[model samples]
Target: MTVSENDTRSPLLTVRDLAVDFRTTDGIVHAVEGVDIEVYPGETVAIVGESGSGKSTTAMAVIGLLAKGGTVANGSISFDGRELVGLSENELRKVRGNQIGMVPQDPMSNLNPVAKIGTQIAETLLAHGQATRHNVNEKVVETLTAAGLPDAERRAKQYPHEFSGGMRQRALIAIGLACRPRLLIADEPTSALDVTVQRTILDQIATMTQEIGTSVLLITHDLGLAAERAARVVVMHRGRVVEQGPAQQILNDPQHPYTQALVKAAPSVAAARLQPQVFATERGVADGSDGSGGSDGFAGSDGSGGSATAKPIDNIVEIEGLTKVYPKRGSKEDFYAVKDVSLSIPRGETVAIVGESGSGKTTTARMLLKVIEPTAGVMRFDGQDVAHLKGKELRSFRQKVQPIFQDPYSSLNPMFTIERIIAEPLEFYKRGNSAQRRAKVRELMESVALPNSMLHRYPSELSGGQRQRVAIARALALDPELIVCDEPVSALDVLVQDQILTLLSDLQRERGLSYLFISHDLAVVRLISDYVCVMKDGELVEAASSEEIFTNPRDPYTRRLLASIPGNELKIAS
Candidate 1:
């Protein structure tokens, strides 16, 4: 819990009384407030908070990327004793990539869609005057290789779409590290990636940063990753610093109530899915009592009320001999995204579909949603044939079942306010007019624990967690019998995920709703689902009650997944 040697009298970067405001039409939205933080040289500092905690805004303000209508109204941001508060955009841009580099959370936003990635990276080096035309390509290849991209020479010429999510993230990291800036700000670099890929990407950054002695301001909601990777932790709430200290201390002995709640929500996802007991950790204060490594295995509890609902064993939705294949002209064979898969979700019960990236979990969900027709399958929803349903029948089928997507950021329209986002579903079905819809929107917001005042705010104005809540509210607008929650809480922070999970559980119990929850985090699935279905290579490898699946994972893939989860006992030594 003690501060390490890196915490000297003077820091590499320091901020005091920092505040930001956006002059919107309605009023000024106080985004950040009276914030003070410091990042020492050769130290990694993680800013941890739920959505709307101003974590990303702080990072953006540091790099001068504050969005339209936003301005830093108060306080000072100093880098190496130089003030940056009143600096011009041109000056900030020069200082940004040269002295401070950033790796954004979503690669799609930062990456140029039309331009070649190699040329884009070369531009970064060229901007800083670090590489000539002759050496630029070589530098790009070397940097890409260092970022862990395979066939860096040829891959550099490819467009952003040609690369996978993890590779795209690596490419972004390559650009950020291209300048070899003294400070690197990585905002949720691994949020979209699977666990294995996440580990690999983070480890690459960790290794390279150490070799170059680059300080990192790591902003993410994943407490497990923060605990594993960061040296120091800063917890922010409502744009203020709630807690700040050593990563081990914050993870193991968090002082603030908010910090304690977040730490308690860190799940060993793999272990929990395998068995519930792994999640039963003793609650302790700063002294770290009940020491058995003070680690909780999976059961990924969202700090919600504990109650078990008994349900019938019959599958509410059943798919038999499900096969989906896409045929390309002149091709010898079709692409089997999902092949002969069978799965079931019990009535008023939660069923989780889990797998690595591109393992067909989403494809299965799409087939269930009927967005994409299955090439061959016998699907039943509420004991009626669904695969055969089309047009009006399909519309009615959709009414019975709804879907919550992985990224709420993209799910909701940027132009719409919170009220519009929630009301779109109600209006589509002609459920109510303006006044009724407004009332329903308010009720939905209350149900999702979003502030009623947020109804008028745009998606760009809200934080990550808040936006997801808006998405949840929109999903709940139809009051469907079952919802296909696809990574509903993945983009959220530990505490926010806890709140959302608790809300979903409460809603299900009160409304008699069922869920087909799809996620990569096994711990989340274990906490929310009554039944677990593990998928691998377009096949259902294991399916059982939560208790049985966790207690006795039958498949080798399931066992390996349980083994890979980050647990308290598996702490990487400093």
Candidate 2:
């Protein structure tokens, strides 16, 4: 795992014994150990690791994005024949977004809300003087189009909030590549997107970088993405490069145990084992039950666990003729996010709601939550019509049904400690006093298998998975009967996801919690749900027991979703 001085020649970007320490109240925290990575010209190299493996710290270090109190105490970073260590903020600013570009993981926060997409991209070009005032607009259009945004000219006028998650991500990349920087650091750029969108964006990135001879430092947890996109893969663990080699070799014939564990931990790999070698989940795909004998889904191969069998349950929540229409603001035409969708979730059950991005899954969940009043339809929770409820009744309703958002990081208050974040709900609900709330927070943390010591840590101190566990603990603090889990584990690693799923299953059994789980990841749904509801284009295409859906799918769209999963009997090299 050690790279000596002999390994430094002809490297576009070189790191020698990089170390990062965060100054905290608990004293200096060693965030990154002595780490080293190399990115050569025209090379697409990936830094792959689980949450808290220090993959991101190294990426941030390479680009000088490490914030205040985070010091790179050791190591020298040489990029493009220049020493990057000890550069002033202003000096680094000149290099960043010009010679070295970054595609941050979360586009929602990365993009400026007030700026138009075109202007944001144009600013990058303007910063580097790549385009004059008059030419910047044209260059922006061309760049946006290259990033795979259709009708770049018209789309350019839109603000960051107007674009969908995938499109917003493209805009971020467009901004990053507006000047065609020599090195592009993509940090989990495809994680927020669906499989199709992920492939398209990755392809666009790969093609654009290759065409311009730009090297890429791809930081991601998705091993499949690393395999498909990166030429060389560097497996990182706890701020160290445990393994580095060709993608095919590292992925198929992984030498490091951690790398092998990551590959084996893929939910898609579990999907590969299903009969017909397809994945079946709540992702609006017909439970891959075509009788193809491709037998395998989340059914754990080792026999310790497997995909959940879909079974009938007593009704807990039901939506009849659900419809949500959004006014086009300046226009009279309305956007129908959910259309005539009917679904039912039984007590102590999980019903997966699957769809591509912008398929109205979130809108549907919101309608059920009554966060946004439904344009039409009847939502019944615990056998009461909730659609028409308002005021205090709605507040009471929300207490009984809570949600776990897709990004647990943002859902949590960054300024508050984990204890306070979880305690906020308990305080608001007037469930207990300060001491009682603290006790409840600890209990909730224990339920999620989080370390009690983390109770005092802030969001900035915890890893993605740990932060997600905090979110779950906070959700459970309300002691709700039905929890709407929206892509809860989509932002996490496979191993973390497995642990979360196991925790959720254990919670359901122990607490008898009913869950309306919504996600595009079918394998995860199969692992947890008792029933499945497949949605496509704002409509429910099919609904059945988990076993019935997987064994006897009646919808073609459902079947296609199953087929789209990347793994099947194909034994990856390692």
Candidate 3:
């Protein structure tokens, strides 16, 4: 599927010297300028970049779906020999679902919460004239089945709330492909899902689109994903196309500095750097460059981006036979969310627990944080039984342990300034006087690499990464010995995620911090963990050093997780 520069077929989508502008409150902002791309029938092309790099904006301009205050300032968007730049709303509506389709990023935000899944898909089918009212029900099920959802008929009747994140994503894919359009634009389609689910959804897209001979324009921040899925990769940076070439070519030897940084920052490529022998020999993964200018895999950031942490000599926290059981309704058997799980976090090191959704990883973290009481277990922190702590001891334990949550947008208070957000804990604990607390807040901000100028800015004024930095600063305000990091970098792009990981690692070394890291992303787990714990179905199935786990995994499930990593099969050696 490698499409060369001289690809002969007339592109299904072509943008020639496109320029886009937005009317911001401050002034007119040029979002995209002089950008060009093509998508041939049945070919896949990716637009990869950071959040504000104009990748998504370029895609939106193609479908005439620009946000308010945005418009195409110049150039032409030719789709199947028809120009779409100046089309009216009515004209564009006719062309949208019938000729082109889009699957946006967040499924929860896109799906209609008040409507049934079938009704939503039916609306698209009816609008596109793909099905009549009498046969629309049957068509809906067919579409869902094609999108790889099992029991489509029953699933169709459920609301969006009833479906899991992966299931909801499948429904979006079904709706996007229902019209069988000539082009499909998937924007960050699998950014939030687990590796296994992400692979399933992408596979379904590839199969369904190839069957229909539909072209794909994938928008994502993951270079490894683009390398694995798309035939060509278009690297964007600061509202411009920095480079364009074959997927493997860009992945192996990127020309642009930003592109090289992205490759090195990717989890799949970085994790591969840990122990290339495991993947190169036993798993059929060939030796390849990690885009860090090294023959062997080396994800550059001080030459140890994904290497295992040094072993620590002390246990900061330990658990014995942890279990949590919830009673079912109407005499059904009690459900076990976490059962007999035992693990320990070494002092001044990171321990990662990885599993898919409903795998009890989060449940176990909650128990460790004392957010939820375990049914039967002995939890010890600093050699004290945490379950028996009450009054001042419990409050002191709370001060010593803190949580850095998943979503940066929700973790901080929008109404408060960054200074207040960071200073709240210090104020609550009565750590110092007003002036001292403010100084402490500034110190925490500086520790997390935030500027002093942004002290008075609200959370809404900051980007996702900035807000996450603020979250870390808040967590560090209490000077906790242990931090329960629940997917702290899951929502961030590669570059920002790399910064956060680096910050965490530095903090651990400086302050002797212990991290109980929980995530479904094995790649990130590989990058930041000293010991790896593999969980499934409420049980701890495998536990070992990060180096041993990634290289020579003994458990089949662990091997499967490694195999599903994006770009796991790509040979970037040359």
> What TM-score goes with each of the models?
0.80, 0.78, 0.92
In terms of lDDT, the poorest run of 10 residues in model 2 is 296-305
Model 2 CA deviation exceeding 4 Å by range: 1-11, 20-30, 69-72, 80-99, 269-313, 370-372, 381-400, 409-445, 450-467, 474-480, 542-574
Using lDDT as the yardstick, the better of models 1 and 3 is 3
RMSDs, each prediction?
A: 7.8, 6.8, 6.8
- Residue pairs in clash, model 3: none
TM-score attained by model 2: 0.78
The order by descending TM-score is 3, 1, 2
Residue 435 lDDT in candidate 2: 86
Model 2 has an lDDT value of 0.78
Structural RMSD, model 1: 7.8
Which ten contiguous residues of candidate 1 have the minimum total lDDT?
279-288
lDDT of 2 by residue, 1-574 (tens): 1223456558889888999999988899888887877887887888988877888888898878887789898988999879998999899999998899889998989898998999888888988899999888999999999999999999999998889988999998888888889999999998878766776787788888878888999998877767667778888887778998877777678887788888767665244221121223432223435443212222101111123554322467877788888779899898888898877775776777887877788888888887888878888888889977878887788788988998878999999999999999889879978888888888898899888999888999998888888998998998999999999998788788877777887888789888889988776777777666777788777666566656566688777666554343335653
Give the winner by lDDT: 2 or 3. Answer: 3
Model 3 regions more than 4 Å off: 269-313, 571-574
Cα displacement (Å) at residue 185, model 1: 0.9
